[model samples]
Target chain A: MTRRRRRLYFIVSSLTMLGVATALALNAFRENLVFFHSPSEIAEKGIPAERRFRLGGIVEENSVAQGNDGVTISFRVTDTAASVPVRHRGLLPDLFREGQGVVADGSLDKDGTFIATEILAKHDETYMPPEVAAALKKAGRWQGE
Target chain B: MANWHRLANPTLFLEWSRRVRPWTGVATAALLATGVYLSLFVAPRDYQQGDAVRIMFVHVPSAWMALFAYAVMAVASAAGLIWKSPLAHLTAKAAAPIGASFTLLALATGALWGQPMWGTWWVWDARLTSVLILFFLYLGYIALWQAIDDHARAAKSAAILALVGVVNIPIIKFSVDWWNTLHQPASVLRMDGPSIHSSLLTPLLVMGAAFAGYFVVVLSIRLEREVLARQVRTLRRVQSRG
Candidate 1:
């Protein structure tokens, strides 16, 4: 093949690869955005009934209580400025406790109780995920501790 | 300046890398020593994770390097296939194991860190799964090189696989954001300024620099060895002809 023909082939293949990469990047950006709303945001603009969404915040101090059955638990989640009461049944995550970072997925009742179907507790002390940190900051509750 | 591709020529690489080799080695040693000290001792404990956060200095850099090394290898393979350059193929071949080792380091460290934080040793999360695939792709690339005895054929086939595998790079990067998983979102790189405290960012960045520097030094050594092997093969062919 002539040098010109070989150059054309190289150009075409490189462009194809570039095109594929761009497509994947855009798809990833669009699909991966799961909006995690903090308790303050939910308080300001309410979540639709039965809308499954992620709610995260610090577990409010002195709000954690074990029911008579022991498996049922109740606590208030706070973004610092506002707190939402949450009632979760079943086993709590190993890291779940009062005054720690947490993210729960469930829906709100008309009475404004967060009935968490699934609860996720942060692993480290004073450490919440970056998303949790952002929500907390936005709610004016960030301790940065 | 556009003649930068000429650097891929084996003789040119040999001459240049020889002169710079000792400096790269010294720099790699010093930077790594300092990085280790800073990451382990000098960096303040994270308010939350405490000592476990030190793993970030090692894990994040290795994870970054694993992606970086594959990109380098893929580009080198492209050069080899496009220009029919043996030197480019050898460079790409030399880089495969290094990339694989970095991927392994990232995975192993990630598992150890995850155990305490996530309360699990492994998860089929998107980020973790994509990285596991990357590690496999590295192994496959290396295996392809050995499976084919003909140098030209082996390089041609292996280059195609490397090019195909480039799709996974973005997936690995975006996996945490794309799906709900146990892994935390990025701290250092974001549209907003890094939310991580400076105490953590300092050692992490320094370790990242040290890892990149070490890759260059090791790649140069591997490429030098590959070039020498080629010379030996050529000399034997001449002797047999004589």
Candidate 2:
């Protein structure tokens, strides 16, 4: 066989092995790789109240309310299939709003309310002019917050 | 193979690249000018993000270029290793700093965009972390090239590193899908057409093209320098022996 052909074979086989190895490794550590768990996942899996974890989902519409001090807020995070109530102190991010994606970190209380030490807003993939967005809303074509 | 050999010749490669450099430079300037204008003045504010959304115009393109340049470097590294092409090794060498700069730019701009939007300047989420790994890989590749005294050995080691690091590219691209990430999933490169409206998408595409043109221009200039530097090294060695 030619030297070129031999080099080609070596490269191809090594690359394949590397890819398979990565795939297997990623698959094995899938839970650790996940940044956050949805309400449904947490609920279905019966996450212990003591385990510190991140709960992520959309901030359900009309589910937000202010605590007596105004420094604390309570809201429900939902994946439509399930919703987890979350209580957060201090200020929310600028982008935080109803019908917006959020990821909150902390453990659940005995009542199952997530006590968040940190709140992070998650942006969706959609982008458009405000005017276009308004028109979509007016036409009932808007699919996002 | 003959045609490949002809192009591989340093003198011929220099001649062709020299002819192409000015055109690429001009293209870079023109496209960047137009893209910036469109992004800043023409594109409307986002419904949610308002003015902050404009950051994506710069952030997305730099991130795209970061990945694109690495892909170029890895391919060149492969060619260098497989074919023993002098031009290919130099091409990979030329691309390292440029790709690293883009990766850094992407990370910086991402931080700028993330602070207000995501409520954090950084995260160890899959998408963000993988891109950070890519930046480190670029740094490691550049360090390998500099640390080795023997040019041939340096090139071979760097090529192997580049090939291994190519695995991160797909990981970065798919990280958003494979795991939950705060950085958001693919927008423009989705199966369903781009989620961005045309007004926003046009400027983004223009900026992407501009970044590509800039990469080409810089890569050619650096490649040309690498060729000349190799010639000078060879001449110095011969003169010392004489």
Candidate 3:
């Protein structure tokens, strides 16, 4: 009985210690752990023009435009509070559309336009049938853009 | 205390487990058949994703089982280490490979779904990275068992590893919420209830239950083999002594 008790205490204490150490480490590296920075975060932090970083947000409605050459695309990514104009010269993902979440990798241009080297679509957790979605839209209950 | 000790006996454990093993096997087959039918034929297509949403029936269930199996292994390891229960160690050992398979399935299915939906095959986001670590932990636990010749020493070492790796479970679960991952947040499991519509949610849940039933069936079979092997080893030792 005493041995079992000792084992229990040891395991519990060690797990606690490990948990605390992990918490500390994660806290220290919190900034580095984020997969991408939102437009709002970038707007507040003001990333340097030369520093390459991923910019993520929803593609603002009616902001997508094609360049005269038809090879380049321009869109404004928005987080409701802030928006960033991004220019890309490549194929976009099939899911890329107006009012959809997107993450772009590149650096800011001299004119503050984001030059995207690559782009990825972001999916939301919501899943429903087209009819239900249409009904939600009609009812003004659809949050998904 | 007496009943607890009796329950710990490998022979008794096997006898009781045998009664339930066949039932679990049947349940797994039945549930999986119905789940597959519902997922493929009955579940409504997503408004945004269309028919591509069908992947969730398999991917979500495999991902769920991956985490569930690890939890079982961790708890059993802790019990074995604390109470000196050989059956607990065997249970943990039996679960490792099954859990690893589920983890692999989840990763593969996620990649398949991500390619067209997210436009990437893989990323080092927090949620994805943590699940990959879980797969490695399962591998490490299984390798530790094979590396040691002595059964007791092997069980002890693997138990420690299993317990230490338990920390990854919560991290994998909440990584999307805690970090800016491309992976979507929880839809089925949340404080506000499932965000997914019932048409899709029903099939996903049925598949999840089927996977759980499959785990129970496989665990029982592997555990029976482990117990028999131990008994044979002990019998040989006794004969040599005589």
Tens digit per residue, CA lDDT, model 1, A74-123 = 89999898998988897565556677777777899888889888776654
Model 2: how far residue B11 lies from native, Å: 0.5
Q: In candidate 3, residue B18 scores what lDDT? A: 96
In order, candidate lDDTs are 0.78, 0.88, 0.88
Per-residue lDDT tens digits for candidate 2, residues B31-83, read 99999999999998888899999999999999999999999999999999999
Candidates 1 and 3, the one with greater lDDT: 3
- TM-scores, each model vs. reference: 0.71, 0.91, 0.91
Worst 10-residue stretch by lDDT in candidate 3 chain B? Answer: B1-10
Error (Å) of candidate 1 at residue A3 is 38
Let me know the TM-score candidate 3 reaches against the reference structure.
0.91
lDDT of 3 by residue, A52-99 (tens): 988999999999999999999999999999999999999787789998
Q: Which ten residues in a row have the lowest lDDT in candidate 1 chain A?
A: A122-131
- After TM-score superposition, what is the CA distance of residue B134 in candidate 2 from its true location, in Å? 0.3
For model 1, residues B1-242, the per-residue Cα lDDT tens digits are: 23546676678889999999899888888889988999888887664565778888899999999999999999999988888888888889999999999999999999888776545566545577677778877877776676565678989988998999998898788766776555666777776777676666777888899999989989999999999999998999899999
- Model 1 captures what fraction of native contacts? 0.05
How many steric clashes between backbone atoms does each model show?
2, 0, 0
Q: Evaluate model 2: give its lDDT.
A: 0.88
Candidate 2 wrong stretches, greater than 4 Å: A1-32, B1-4
lDDT of 1 at B172: 82
